[model samples]
Target: MRLLLLAVIAALPAAAHADEAAERGEWLARQVCSNCHTISARAPAGRNPRSPPFSAIAARPDVTAGTIATYVRQPHANMPDHGLTARQAQDLAAFILAQKPR
Candidate 1:
């Protein structure tokens, strides 16, 4: 029981950190990616036609979270450079992956 309690306590901070990352990622996406891409179901009715929506990007079979993070670090020509830090890139990647369509 003591060990179990310790494990649960240890997990709490990690879970909170994960939630923080998700929130930060969402905020970053709204502030930046929302400019040129649809970030959510009810996002502003605007954005570059050429840019894939986050949901679409998330749904792509070939696109994984790691790849998305890498793209954030080194985007292709059509996508502008956001100059995001590594943490921000990971956060954005998390935000994008969270947008998978049903």
Candidate 2:
């Protein structure tokens, strides 16, 4: 029981940080990605039908935060380069991953 308690305490800070990152990512998505992608589950499809919703992306089995970050940093034919900093991309990835179906 003591070992378990110690482990849980050690993990709390990391879990809290992840939660914070997810929150920041959600805000950034609403401000920027909302124009093209549906950033939240309840949001209507974006004007660009070709752009996928964050939920769909999260649902994919192979999707990972690193992959999402890489995609966000690259220039795409349809997506305008937002020049998001590395930390922003990380936060966005965290937010998107949080949308994965439980």
Candidate 3:
């Protein structure tokens, strides 16, 4: 019973942290990426040809959440460097990764 209680206690914090992360990600996506890309279901009209949709990005095998975050922080090529901080990029990546493929 003690072990079970301890496990439950440990899991509670993890669950809370995950929920917090998800919330942060969602907010970041809405604020930062929604302007250029469709970050959510009701994104603003105006698509850029520069990058794929967030859903497509999420489904990409080569680009994991971490990779996306890194790229967003320091973009390459014609992509103008947005200068997103590490935490902002991480949150955006988390939001993008949470999206389901269409």
Candidate 4:
């Protein structure tokens, strides 16, 4: 059983890291993104027609992690630039991607 236990222990860091990223991303979304964007499917009803839901963005064919990272760093006329760091952008991207429709 030692070998099996060692395997599980060794495998945990990556999973934990991903979980941490998703958590940070959710927090960032709630604090910053939620102001204009609906970050979930079951969010406040009657979303603003102008802003698309995060789930929809996540589900889009071209919305990769890199796409999200780039968007967060750049200036958009509508979106408020939170001036997120690379790690923060990565975390948010992971969170958004995680919300993709199964």
* Model 3 lDDT tens row, 1-102: 999999999899977876676679788767666667777665664367665678778888898868988988886784567788887777777778877576
How would you encode candidate 1's per-residue C-alpha lDDT over 25-64 as one tens digit per residue? 9899888888888888878743699888898999999988
Stretches of candidate 2 above 4 Å error? Answer: none
Which portions of model 1 miss their true places by more than 4 Å?
A: 1-15
Give the Cα error of residue 99 in candidate 3, in Å: 0.8
Candidates ranked by lDDT: 2, 4, 1, 3
Model 1, global lDDT: 0.84
**For residues 2-97, could you state the per-residue lDDT of candidate 4 as single tens digits?**
999999999899889988998899888888887778876755632467887778889999899899989988988977778899999999998888
Candidate number with the higher lDDT (3 or 4): 4
Clashing pairs in 3: none
TM-score of each: 0.79, 0.94, 0.72, 0.80
lDDT of 2 at 6: 100
Sorted by TM-score, highest first, which candidate order results?
2, 4, 1, 3
Deviation from native of the Cα of residue 80 in model 2, angstroms: 0.8
TM-score, cand. 4: 0.80
